[model samples]
Target chain A: MAFRTDHHLTGSVNIVTALPAEARPLVGHFELRSSRTDPFSVYTNGDSSVRLIVSGVGKSAAGRAVKHLAGLFDSTGSNAWLNVGIAGHESLPLGTMVAAHKISDEKTGRSWFPPMVLDFPCETATLLTVEEETDDYPDNALVEMEAVGFYATASDFSTHELIHCLKVVSDNRREKKLDGKSVSELITAQLAAVESVVQSILQLSAELGKRRVVPRQLKDFLEQWKFTVTQSHQLEKLLRRWEVIFPKADPFEAASPESRNGRDVVQLLSRQLAEASVEAEQL
Target chain B: MIEAIYIEEAVRQHRRTAEILTRFPKARLIPCERYGEVFNPRSQDFKIQKRRPALILAEKFDNFVLPTPDGFGIGGTENYYFSHMLNCLYDCRYCFLQGMFRSAHYLLFVNYESFMDAIDSTLDKSTTDKTVTFFSGYDCDSLALETVTGFAEAFLPFFRERPRALHELRTKSVNIQALLKTEPLDNCVTAFSFTPAEISEKVEHGVPPVKRRIEAMKQLAERGWPLGLRLDPLIYHGRFESNYRRLVNDLFAAVPAEAFHSVSLGAMRFPKAMFDPMVKLYPDELLLAGPLHPSNGMVTYRREVEEEMTQFCRSLLGDYLPAEKFFHCAPWS
Candidate 1:
């Protein structure tokens, strides 16, 4: 599918969960409503910027759901992807929250480290993704079924800094299994922490979005002149430079009546900027 | 402060790694087979990682020492640079490290003996009888993390044994407690880099103020340690001359020229590859928005501006120091 050109979904969040019980707390906490339910269940809030998808159980399912959600929006925008679910640990008490610093695939033995760039709300631990649901948790690590798939797929759509996984300890050595009700209760118990994580990631995504915002005048210039694919890129770069060099001034003031095309405009701005001197106050 | 520490499996049992780990007992420890697994990835953002960079302990397999780029020496016939660490603690906007590496996590090689062995071998194979200057802080600041790395403590004694070999520790840090406690060595020169106060306050984030660094230099000079001045990457502004003159006068007032070993000046320049990423990172940065253009695969100011800045600083510096102590560094030349 073709991506959306309008940046209405910038600084959005896409969440993936392997079970409906794990996703119920997040959907309700974020006030998300059902948006799609044919192939997979998806929920989104009012503006459709915050989304949650239930991927039913297993690695392949979670990977497919992430790919599907990513295809529904403009992937080029600064969006965050998070995998929130329950995992089994050896010694941690039930309802304890943790973020994954290292995720390893038990089948392939390949590992990925998610760079933590923010002051995370919860503690961090190594997470091992296994093929089957087992009570065998590795020493000092959490064992789950879908984090490796969720992370490995989401990385292709966003930067590692914006991709993360937060897990709640639902099963441990003392209690090796839990029902759907218990899983939902465990996720609901930590709803405030999950909300804080979402707020932090959203703030970071917004900061990144601000850095990549295009100059407002570019749209007007593009509508006025016809530019080829390569010339459009050149025009955008020149416009950005003009904005930096002459922030308070307008590029239209420098364009002469003799200018005929986008190339002429690009040359005019380049010449003017080259002649300009950088002042101390500008910094 | 470091929030996490990534330990390479090969160096998990290294003595230096154990010593460093004891310093940050509260940091989360994560183990990996190689440091490259965490450092060399493509999707990581340097700006965000710089906010809270982790510490990676790994072993260097090879390339412990390499020759410095041409025109990068002070007075030695043979100049070599070695990096015991990969990145700096401070986030200077003009730093090449921002463009060279995709990740900002500090990768420190724990195998100090291998570096000593390699330096010893390089000294044995030296073809010239003239002195060989070994430079630290090319890739990382030599003294910024002294308390945590103990880099100066470990390597100073080795250089002391070889009197003919000269060592230069380049830094912008005021962390001179280690240097103050240890006995002074004639072969070691503690070099400090500086810019004008106006520019330093804007671009050099997390760096110690200019006055504090000068105070550190005064303390070192009083203890009989030779010092070097690096007034490099000269930034241009409307009041460039007046600001630089004030800086030079302030520096001379603190430390006399008799304690100086050498001084060098360089203009602001970067390879096109590096400059492109920096501009992308900070598109609105006034320094990058200046009158810079591509010349011979490098981005630098116009020829007249570069020459004018260089000549003005050179003439101003010549009034205090001798001609032999001045060196002009033009890496792209």
Candidate 2:
């Protein structure tokens, strides 16, 4: 498959789990890296792009995976981030596929999840990202490591195109055991549905890619700050905010500078404006 | 910084409406007998109102400062939270905003002065020696909307007047330009909510990256604003120790432990009722993947798992700060 900046890869259907043994067969050939710096391979579906990165388990590793995957896509292009993997379930039956509606960190109670992974046709609920594997989840039903980091880091790089976190229930509190080989069998059984889910995600990304607009609110702030378009992109590129929304606007266009205008307007309104005014005269 | 004006209509006949308006004088008042009429309900999704989210363009507010959630402070008792606006621009899958509001439209209370006046009263009521903490970035990110509202710059002087009152501006936003332009305040703590790099990429929707957030933290710390690290909603994953350790290493590497005012950590837990609706929304997320057992009616990871992670994290934090400074939400001894 050819790589097109405008073409978006959906349904990366990332398997972010410790149950790599479960995901190995269902997924195409896999790659591993010590960290994001290692070169990675991407699967192309002719029209879209897909990269099955084994982001080592945990919020930080997941966050790094998100950052690295986001880096693979042109900042200004359309990209969707996913954390496809297996998880533990409490209420539902074994082998139930759960979508993490929300991803909360057990360590920092701060939430970095999207609203429920809204699946109208099926049941969806919040997925708590725990740092440990245990039956003690207070409110969340499914458990995984990388979802929050993926959402947090990727959302920074892209705009709204990220999607997909299909988690097959591997362990139940009732059972209190994990059989890696058995879990792999369950995922393999659902391979076709997983493929379909991945396809739908890519299709959605392609649709979202066309005519992406940087919110006027963000644009206005960039302008007021006197950030030249290139300068804005430079800051955004470093910030990675421009990664998903870039490669579209001329990077030198007026929107970037205009965004800083909002900041400038506030500066002028504050008494702090006086300091800047004096500084301006010195310049 | 917003050039806001407030308009009063017959709706002022309603006390809440009238009270909301008295607060924002600078806001351009656009009077319509009805705000956008699209707020009715749809059968499929209960979260979105048929009407757009209600927008209250007010002239002022009764108070700009509000008390923080109970059991929220890491080490302090005098806690407070305030919002210059309501609603976030980015739509994440797990946001409580979906469950909390009938509408999605943002409500920007344009009144800056009334809120300031309330702050004065609150400050007067509290003893000067005890730190009266005012928290911003609750209903909205403190700095995310600052470009439009300039709330932080507006209240900086107010908090400055009462140095005894500590101001904490918490946010997941990277809008540090506002914080950068001004001199750092000893009384103010600029706190950023960060997840590991990987979790942020997949789930945070539209927040800034972890590195950029660290950069912003570095910038603020360099400027002398007391920095705070919020390792919130610590998502679990395999090889989790190494992942979080890197996050800690990355953060400390960027900013020194001495520069931090404090670091707070907690796990994913929500009120019982909020769970079902949130679940209905995002059925595909892995963060939701696990055996969900409840404790004391609030939903969260099972007790043993929660305690283990909390203990693990507390020790990790001890590597940087004294054990006395670290705070946990569960309150278990």
Candidate 3:
């Protein structure tokens, strides 16, 4: 059900999985509706937020799926990418949900440490993404099929904080076999843990969203002053700083120095900004 | 409070590393060949990672002891600085560490003995008459993480033996329980950094309040620990003179001025290289708005404002302590 021209895909959350069964419980629980106009099965909320994509198994598939979904649904780069699936841990009990502290691609032997800032009560473990499930859990990590691909691709789309993989332990060495129904049930059982992670990620997403958004006054100033490509970037960065330091003060309401070029305006703002900054720190 | 600790594979078997691992039994220990493999990546965002910084137990190779910048010392013959840690526990907005390193994670070089050996050799070569002052909190808070690293406990004895080489543990931390238990030595100076309570509440993230820091200094002074005051990077906040005056008047009253070993003062400044990046890192901070001008090569307060501030403080501080005890650090010193 995934489609092109996601102009209506103005969502803040993207949930991707390697299989349809793994994505089913989340889509159903969150009331995600599938569309008939897309090539892949994509479930979207009625509010046009929270897209669930069921990419086929393997690293390439997961990477391709993220690229496709991100291109269509995440124009803002603000969406949190959640790659959910079943993984095999050497010792963790079946159905145990552990958020990844470190994710390493088995074939490449490369690793990425996701800074676990949120203090969740659930157990934490390293994840090794392999091409296929293995009984020989080589290292002390949760073995999965889609993490590296998801992380490698999703991180390119959004911040690493916004891109994370939450896996449910479905197999270890002894319990290697699992049917589709069993996988679905295992994924469904860890929904609560998944929700907790989602909430934390969303909170981080929201905080970053505020910091990046340009205020209306800066936009108006940009329209009035002819800032060059370089100055515009500086202005944007400065305005974000302004919002942080002088949260209550209004940039537009401040006394305007009339008839100045972009350079002059920048200089004026810089002077006022510096004074305000120093003053703010003063007792 | 640490959720994850990235341990360098080389130090996995080190006794100190093992002992630290035992303390944080809950943190997931990620193994790597070198700390740089985990710490030197450009992909890591200092902002996002700052929300929850990991503890990297690493092994520092060279440059264990370096000379302090020309004006960084509080008066001495030969001043040298060393960092057993790469980063700090508290996040001060004005700190140069933010721009100096790409990662916000704290990297503790577990090989403290190597550093002491380096210090020992360096000090052994110097003449005993020339008082060599070694600064400890150059790259990180020397005492803020005392309990976690047992840094002060380990080094106090090292300095006690090397009486000719004085040690200054500059920190904003109040964790002096370790020092309280040991015999306070004159060769060691426990320097406490302070800012206006009003400014501290805003920019010095994760640091104890001004009152708490002052209390810690008083406790240390009472216990015979030679106390030094570092009013460095004095933020030029509004009505700074009154704030500073009240602060000094209040402080000198509690911890007798006679007990003070030294007091160093400096204005807030950043290298142009560090300033630009800091602007990007803390766009919302008023501190960077400084209409800061580049003098020579560093970005700092205007010459006039800097003079006024330093002169005012120098005059005010002269009222509390002996004129010889006050030291002025030039901007970016």
Q: Which candidate tops TM-score?
A: 1
Clashing pairs in 1: none
Candidate 1 residue lDDT tens string, B1-333: 998999999999999999999999999999999999899977777888899999999999899999988877878888888999999999998898888888899999999899999889989999977788899998899999998899999998899899878999999998988888989989899999998988899889999999999999999999989998988778888789998999999999999888899898888899988887777778788788767766799988888988899899988889899989986443554
Model 1, A28-135: lDDT tens digits are 999999988868899988877688999978889989999998888777637788999999999999999999999999999889999978677889999999999897
Highest-DockQ candidate: 1
DockQ for all candidate structures vs. native: 0.64, 0.01, 0.37
Query: For candidate 3, lDDT tens digit of each residue in B270-323?
Result: 888888767666656667665466677788888777778888888888888788
Query: Can you write out model 2's per-residue Cα lDDT over B245-313, one digit (the tens) per residue?
Result: 888889888987877887778776666566645644443334442334345766566666566766777
Q: State which candidate, 2 or 3, has the greater lDDT.
A: 3
The DockQ for candidate 3, computed on C-alphas, is 0.37
All candidates: CA RMSD (Å): 1.9, 24.8, 3.5
TM-score of 1: 0.96
Least lDDT summed over 10 consecutive residues: which range in candidate 1 chain B?
Answer: B324-333
Give the per-residue lDDT of model 2 (tens digit) for A1-283.
Answer: 2223445323233334334655465444333222233533333333335555656667788777666556555654346556667777776677777655445666776443232212223345556788866776454457777677776666665432245466777767676335667767767766666666656555645544443433334554464466556555434322222222232333324334433453443322221211111111111
